[model samples]
Target: MIVGIDLGTTNSAVAIWRDGAASLIPNSLGDVLTPSAVSMTEDGTILVGVAARDRQSTHPALTATAFKRLMGAQKPVMLGRTRFSAEELSALVLRSLKADAEAYLGEPVESAVITVPAYFNDRQRKATRRAGELAGLRVERLLNEPTAAALAHGIHQREDKEPFLVFDLGGGTFDVSIVEIFDGIIEVRASAGDNRLGGEDFNDVMVELVRGQLKGVDALPLSNSELREIMRAAAERTRRGLTEADTAPFSLVWKGREIRRDVRADAFAEAAAGLIARLREPVLRSMRDSGIRTEQLSEVILVGGATRMPIVRRAVTRMFGRFPNASIDPDHAVAMGAAVQAGLKARDSALEEIRLTDVCPFTLGVDTVEFDRLGRMHSGVFCPIIERNTVIPASRVHVFSTVRDNQPVVEFGVYQGEARQVDANVKLGQLSIPVPPRPAGTVRIDCRFSYDVSGLLEVDLTIPETGASKQLVICDDADAPDDAAIAARREVLAALKVHPREDAANAATLARAERCYEAFLGERRDHIGQMIIGFEGVLQKQDPKQIKEARDEIERQLDALEGERFL
Candidate 1:
């Protein structure tokens, strides 16, 4: 059976279509959400999800998070002795989610539909499909996150037929889209987003606040990694608390100096004020490009866990001059909608009547040379044939002529972006074809582009002069590893033993104590240090009964010293 997976930046989840409805499958921990964190322990063990996240504060150098922002980039993330691309880190998360889905369904799942930010470029989307393949699952479809959210919310709505908007602000990415539904048909009008903008930015703001204060008195006495993890843990706690309470205090100790500050809603809003401003531009652009008026939108729906923050809600309301609908859980909407899409792909009886359509989030064009009447030529100009937000499963063709007399070949550099210059756009791929030498502007070539709903792009070039043609399926081949390389990576991952599933609770407890021990000093630090050693010894015994007994005591001691985790 096919399943739906939401491989997100900060978290991941899995779902399946069952009993005529979409059902979210819980992970081994009996939770619907799993942190999208991966880490290598000091003993050369790889941990994913909860264990990895818990260890992040203690092992910052060997842990990687938020790599989703680097998707399609050339940079490599250095974690310990290895360098990994963004897709490789993402594949680990996907593999973990696949394991969870299989365990819950009691079956071996081989295919899935994964969701991505609506505004992801061609390279990012293709990389996501590659990540799924590396995880041993065939990606059936690449559904846009905002479009998936709409499907989840509008799936059972038989009475409401008005148009709405989906504002998705997750942990590491943001996407805004306008949606219209009529007669069991859902259509996405337009989309816009910032790949690097999200709730994590707010967390960074809190971290900066601490850094600024530390610089005021003296230079940091601790290592950069130590300071970073401490600030991340504290800031995240304060950020999550501020969602429900008006004030959350941030406190930490360094070199006998106590840093204490209360982060109130007003102060946080002031600190995160810039992020709020950035959110407006995308929404306004999406509406303007979609030719939609503010009054035409019957409702504005907020999707993504980041939307739960009051500041985000207030920002949305201020922009639209109306309150947004929060009936659907922002955290689970995307994954749930993915399940619906999975059902649609399978042609399930319940979803047989629902017809959904999406648009291309970017314009596809070729690098062309434009010659002026004065005999001046301008190169690197982007000639768009298919505009952004055009209905998918669509094709467009543009005819071009050679720039110079007897030009031997035509080099086509295909790009996907809004920039007017090819240099500013992302080049998905390129193809060069040899053309019979002809006089300038005499030979014509048909540049046809076809875009499908799955976010894959195909470019076809045909020369009417000689009936010769060339085509390029836009995909990033350089970033994709061969089957042998993929197998090698998998073997390495499989070798780095993940903490046993049954011992997750004990493993988490030990990690938390280690983090606490590193952050404290004086007698409190010594007490936690001994507690950690004791737990480690117990874990080495491999006796589940003994480990549980020791874990309860260790957790109690750490809780007493650390107070509440999110305080």
Candidate 2:
């Protein structure tokens, strides 16, 4: 059976359409949510999800989290002794989700529909698909996250038709999609987002607060990685705490002393003014692109876990002069809607009459020559073909001729963005098709771009006079790995042993205690240290009952010191 997965930046989840409704698939621990974190032990054993996340502060060097932001950068992230590409790291998360789905369904699952931020460029989308491939799943579709959330929202509404907006602020990405539904048909009018803006960026604002407010913080012995992860965890907790209370303590230990500050909601809002401002552009752009005014929207729907924050909700309220809808669970909407999409792909009888259409989030075009004010030919000009927000599956064609007489070849540098210059846009790929030598205007070539439902692009070029033709698939050279490389990475991942599931709770508890030990001071620090020692001693005893008892007690003690329930 095909499943739908939200391969999120901070957390991931999977769901399937069963009994005519979408249901979340639980993992081994009976939790539907999985933290998107990966860690490598000293013995080369891998740990994912909560176990790895708990290790972030304790074993900062060995753990990697929030790697989704680097998806299309083709950069390597070091996890212990190994260097993993963002694709490889994402594949591990996907693999874990796949296992959970299989376990829940009691059957082997192979195909999936994965959701991505609509603002992701061609390279990022392709990288996501590659990640799915590496995890042994045939990616049926790469659904836009906001669009998916829209589907989930539309499904539960009683109205036959309505227009709405989806505001998605995920862990590492933000997207806004304008949607309209009419008589079982869902159409996305426009999409806009910043792949770099999200909840994690807010965490950065909190980190900056610590650096600026805490004395001698700049002189601390923390490495860039350690400081970031450590402060991010603390800031995240404080930020969440502020959601329910006006003030929350942001504290950490340095040497033998405790440093603390009360973070006020008003202060955080003031410091994050720039980020709140950044959120305005996308909503305005989506509204403008869709030709819909704020008042025209029947409801503004909030999606993604980040939207639960009061600050974000207030921003949306101020923008629209109305309270946004939060009827759907922000965290589960995308994955659930993706499951609905998986059902649509399968032509499920229950959804046979429903139709969904989505827009291309960015403009796709090619480089061309344009005459400047002085009549001088300027190359590297961007000539748009498929405009952003054009509904897909879509195809558009444009004709062009050589700029120079007797030009031997016609080259097209495919790009995606809103820039007027090709260099300012993202280059998807380049294509060269041989043309018959002739005067500048004598040879005419037609370039046709076809964008499919799954968000892949195909370019077809044909010269009318000579019938010469060429085809180019949109993919970045550096971002697209060859089959051999994929196989090699798969082998590398398969060879590593995974930390035993039975011991995950104990490990997580110990890791959390270590993190607390680092964050506490004086007596509390000493107490956590002794607790860690006691847990290790229990593990060495090799008695399950004794270890479980010790682990539970230590977790309770850390919870009290951490005030985790308050957060």
Candidate 3:
């Protein structure tokens, strides 16, 4: 059976298309959204979701979360003596989702339609597809998250002629898209986003607020883990409170004393003002790129949990002069849309009557001849094959002549991006076509660029003069390490001796954090002294084991404190 999956940064969800409707499959705990966290028990068993997240307070060193932000990154993450690529870590999450789906359906599910941010570059998209494959699921298509949300919105309304904008701000990514619906056709005219921006930024703001408060108390010296654990809990609560209340009450026991603070809506908005401002660029740019004015957008649809913020809504309303649509649950829209796409893929319902066309968010181009000075040949010209806003399922061809006479083959460098210089763009891959050895001008190579609904690009190099050709699917050839290699690396990663959960690394992190806190505390030593005394009171009641445990917790809090500054 075909299913839909939303592999999010902080959470993941799965849904199936059945009985002409879409239904989300809850996890074992009956939660529609599962935390994207994993932890290994001392016995070697792997735990996912809430159990893993719960362990973060006591075992922050062993738990790994938010790894999704590293997708397509060249760096490797070291975990439990095993090194894992971002793709591999993502695969584990997908595998967990797949297992849940199989249990719900009472059958083995083999294929799915996965949703990604519309602005995900070729490398990031390819990594996501590979992740699905590693999890034993055949990815029929990779739908854009915003586009998928738009599809769900369109399906619910059954509108035949109207245009709307979809703004998706999830845990770790943001996407803005403009879609036009006409005669059962849903076409995405433009897509834009910052892959690194999301609700996490809001949590960082809260963390900073707490750290700032603690710094005012000058006498206490807390460890990193202790500070991180406290701040993490505080940030999480603040994020949840923003969804329903104008302000959130925050309190945490630090250094022994109970510290209390209230975060008002205005303060929250002020702290995140920079991020809110940053979000407007993409919305305006997307609208302009789609050739659709803000006034032309009939409705602005808000999806993803981050959009629940009043600040975000106000920012978008100011830009479009209209209240955004929230008819569909923000958290469920993407998965529902994925289910809709699954229905189309499985041909299980009449939803197949609807068609969608999406475009590559970035420009696709190649290197060409620029100019020569004093008997020299310079190759720096960037020739674009397709511009950003062009409709998808489209192809463009460019011809280039051999620079040297009797050249056996011509090399075509394929790239993606809008940079005029080749160095500034991504080198997707290269294509070389064999041709009859003839004069430079006698050989003709036609380079064709085609992007499909999945946003995957295909490049074909043909020597129409000699009827010789070579085809390269860019996604299939990127220098990603194979699954076997990744697995082998993971084995090595697992063997590496990671610092103990309560090791000296925690102390060092805490030392650095304490310095920052002390610097910030300045003259607030009296308040800090009271809190430190309270912390010691709690510490005195604990046995040696408990003191060590408290120390570990304190270290985690410190990490959270540091994380706030960096974020």
- The C-alpha TM-scores of every prediction are 0.92, 0.94, 0.81
What is the C-alpha lDDT profile of model 2 across 41-131, one tens digit per residue? 8888888888788788768889998999999786899987789989888999999889888877889999999999999888888889989
Every candidate's lDDT: 0.84, 0.86, 0.76
Worst 10 residues of 3 by lDDT: 498-507
Q: List candidate 1 stretches off by more than 4 Å.
A: 156-160, 213-223, 255-257, 433-438, 475-479, 519-534, 537-541, 549-567
Write down the RMSD of candidate 2 (Cα, Å).
Answer: 2.4
Residue 384 deviation, candidate 3, in Å?
1.3
> What CA root-mean-square deviation does each model show from the true structure?
2.6, 2.4, 8.3
Candidate 2 vs candidate 3: the lDDT winner is: 2
Counted clashes in each candidate structure: 0, 0, 32
Best-matching candidate per TM-score: 2
Least well predicted 10-residue stretch by lDDT in candidate 1: 214-223
The TM-score measured for candidate 1 stands at 0.92
The model with the greater TM-score, 2 or 3, is 2
Which has the greatest lDDT? 2
The positional error of residue 425 in candidate 1, measured at the CA in angstroms, is: 1.4
